[model samples]
Target: MARELEEVKWEKFKLGDLFRIKSNLQLNKNSFVFSENGEYPYFTRTVFNNGILGNVHYLDEEHKLKGNCLAVGMIAMRFFYMDKDFYAGQFTKRAIPIGFSLNSRLANYFITVLNKKSKIFQSSLVRNFEKVFKNEEVKLPVKNDGSIDFEFMTSFISELEARQISELEAYLVTTGLSDYVLTSEEEKFLEIFRENEVKWKKFKIGDLFEVNSYKKRFDANKVNILEEGHPYVVRTALNNGIRGYLKEDEEFLNEGNTISFGQDTATMFYQEKSYFTGDKIKIIKSKYKEFNKLNSHFFVSAMSKSFSTFAWGSSSFSISIIENQEIYLPIKNNEINFEFMETLISAIQKEIIKDVVLYTDKKIKATKKVVSNK
Candidate 1:
């Protein structure tokens, strides 16, 4: 059943009236030791990755901004809902609710309002929050008797979250991850190979794939980065490493389906679209007509694990080493078991998709219940 939204009464209020503006402690960049595995998150003017520049273990509770507060970027009009107690970097400010307990979801609502209002004040290096935003009028949901509707705000966010989760689940489905899983019969059948009862022949990497020694054709001058153009740009990373796009180019490097590797990092990526490779990228495609995109992906996954074995950790990653390498694939009666490869990928994808879909479905249902009850 569709949840019907109650009539919301919006009341205008100045920014200062609702929340007490507070600036974060000025900690120098060097004072904080950055690490991916750090205890606490350190936030900066970084608009990307939700303002988390890096993680740190700064144990100053007095200086740290507690969870469920809004962090506003000083220079840029960037805002994020700091859900965890975070160490603030230089040039950052936060909002403390005047009298109410600010939930992170509710803080997200306020950040949305603040982001739209503050966009006009952006681009300037210096920012006077008191002058620009302190008295800025904004609307908030209110009840029948002229009180803030916290429940409605929570429900609104919850409904949106449900929809977003469904969208993500749909996306996961499109990735072919939700296609199929291994049945009991299929799993038992593969136990023979797992037990090493079936002998599989090893093949040299050079025999399967050959690197396309194409010169880099990406020129920033001729091919401008577009909002939506041919995905003529790809890097060595697995996903979303497309720096820019190109409309037209003389040497548009496009291999229908191939594996790309970073010459220095040994970082591998599978490319399906026609895209021009960035600097230090080595492209390799299947030498045999039997192999396709699915096979390339499985090979890339296998090769990614063996990156540490290569001598490229000290020096530049040699394509020659990868070319001369050997990989083992399941073989039946002197032929590659392409069906087994297909089933293997499908089973793996299904397992991942199953977990994600289960979690997301539960969240959506829970959020929907909250919405419906409200």
Candidate 2:
């Protein structure tokens, strides 16, 4: 993909030069009757869901933006490439390809460029996002004669899609390892050595780990700044609980790899760097001896699954409730089978690595072929 972009000549052009833009028609929110069984998607000025507020029964087929059109949110200033014919309601803008033809793949790629540009125009000074995007200039790949390279764009996107699919497949395989799924041959191999009764040991979380609560306060505004810095984040559902990064300063608190959790959100995260945390974030570390044997990544994965058992229907998790939580472990002889835990995680990592390597090789070859053809 990088080679293709490098080979092609690029030309800078204003967004209005490539697209015939249209601001959304004045349609009241009351007219959109959101329903579960609706046919058309009602689009609004929101960042998520391709700006889709909800599915509505309203039918304005002639006025609705066609599939493969780019929709820019006026309020959030984010770009979304519509995949289906949808209703474009109030406070939105649609950009239809003009002169040059664009497939779904190329339009999707353009969305990235537009979104990056939108990020730069932040501040109340640039209140009208639609107006700002209209005049923004973008550099696009062009052929030798300086025409848009649609073929290269399509192939480049396909290459990226293939790689992403492979990574997701690898993730799925690794995550599935926690639940033992034995093949027929493996099942038979273990049958001969399988013991009828296995020893189990139970211990409260506090017994094996140090639950330290830091009293250092982080200013919510400074810590939550969405910029590249040392990770000073609170926990959330996305990106393994990374809300955002923050800068390192005297006020910076917490360090080392440990299991972190959002007490309010009841989500688990593995923090590997020195960072600060929000009010409800709790950090748990294994005892000096236990840390050597226990794998933090494996512990995090297990704890995430166990969250439901403890949290139940509650949205928040109390520190008292978590410290007293007891966990079961397999015992060999009289001691905890730390080797078993290590081996299990190692096996999963090996399998996932194999899948990732194989897929990466295939993606490289495919990308080379596309570049060579050009």
Candidate 3:
């Protein structure tokens, strides 16, 4: 049985009273030796990836931060639960419950409530993090006797996890992605890939696609925003660069299955669905008809490689400049090898899916135990 949120008793408590918030050891990015199999996570101020920039080699005793605590990036107004010891980065803080233990579910509940105040904590007020945030109060569910209701919080999260686990199980079975075994053809293709046998040649961006200059100017504030609307594109490398949803305007809508390139940031993402955006963007549609979803992934990787040596992040690129840029592609007789692109992408997807299946299996087992105990 679950208690509805509306039916639960609530009480307000100052954030400072509930937890001890302290600044994390600020470390330089250059000092980090990052590795794929690193022992600690390097937490950054980014709202993405739960504030983790990447895993890094172990630091000294003073640098190591234990888990089972809330990691806060005050500047970004993001809160994340760290389940293991890791390294902290710039503008980071650690919040530990006062005279209380925080498990994953409990930490999630607290973070969910805390993040509701995130909208007001902008860059201008970042310097007043402790003064402004520590004094702020948050509402939490309580029992009739006035104690905080940890049981209700745990139950709510457990039920949510159970539903997600069931959906994942169905998805794995229906898609047949649960079986991670590699096929004979895939193995052969990988061997050739390992040998670096793929043909490579450069092709100008302008020659492969038509760079469209949107005829009309777009005003974001004037646009009708909707809950269930079309994607409003932005200049970012995260979340496919989609910032929000807006009422679909046929006049402003850019075609689907195209790449949206940010001129100033040089960030690019393949737009799977039709989207609309403002300036500093160049929507490019492929000249060839075979540039579908799978092939688009391969092309995006190649497009990123094109900008790597061009000092992409720090530099700006105009439509004229990007058009002249060339990317190396797998070619057959000096033509783009669409067949090879599709095959390589398919194998890559399966390889990634194997890891996801393993994670889903673990979640399902854990969720079942939570449900059974209830």
Question: Which prediction has the highest TM-score against the true structure?
Answer: 3
Q: Give residue 180's lDDT in candidate 3 (0 to 100).
A: 76
Candidate 3 at residue 9, lDDT?
A: 96
Candidate 1 accuracy as lDDT: 0.72
lDDT (Cα, tens digit) per residue for candidate 2, span 105-204: 7878898888787656554343555466558799988878888777777877877876775566566567553334444543442443255344668767
Model 2 spans > 4 angstroms off = 1-3, 61-63, 120-134, 177-374
Q: Say which prediction, candidate 1 or candidate 3, comes out ahead on lDDT.
A: 3
Model 3, 20: alpha-carbon shift in Å?
Answer: 8.3
- Shift in Å, residue 173, candidate 2: 2.1
Q: TM-score, each model?
A: 0.61, 0.56, 0.70
Please list all clashing residue pairs in model 1, or write none if there are none. none
What's the lDDT for all of these models? 0.72, 0.67, 0.83
Overall local distance difference test of candidate 2: 0.67
lDDT (C-alpha) at residue 252 in model 1? 61
- Compared to the true structure, candidate 2 yields what TM-score? 0.56
Deviating ranges (above 4 Å) for candidate 1: 1-98, 101-104, 110-156, 179-181, 189-200, 220-222, 238-241, 311-319, 367-374
Tell me the lDDT of model 1 at 273. 73
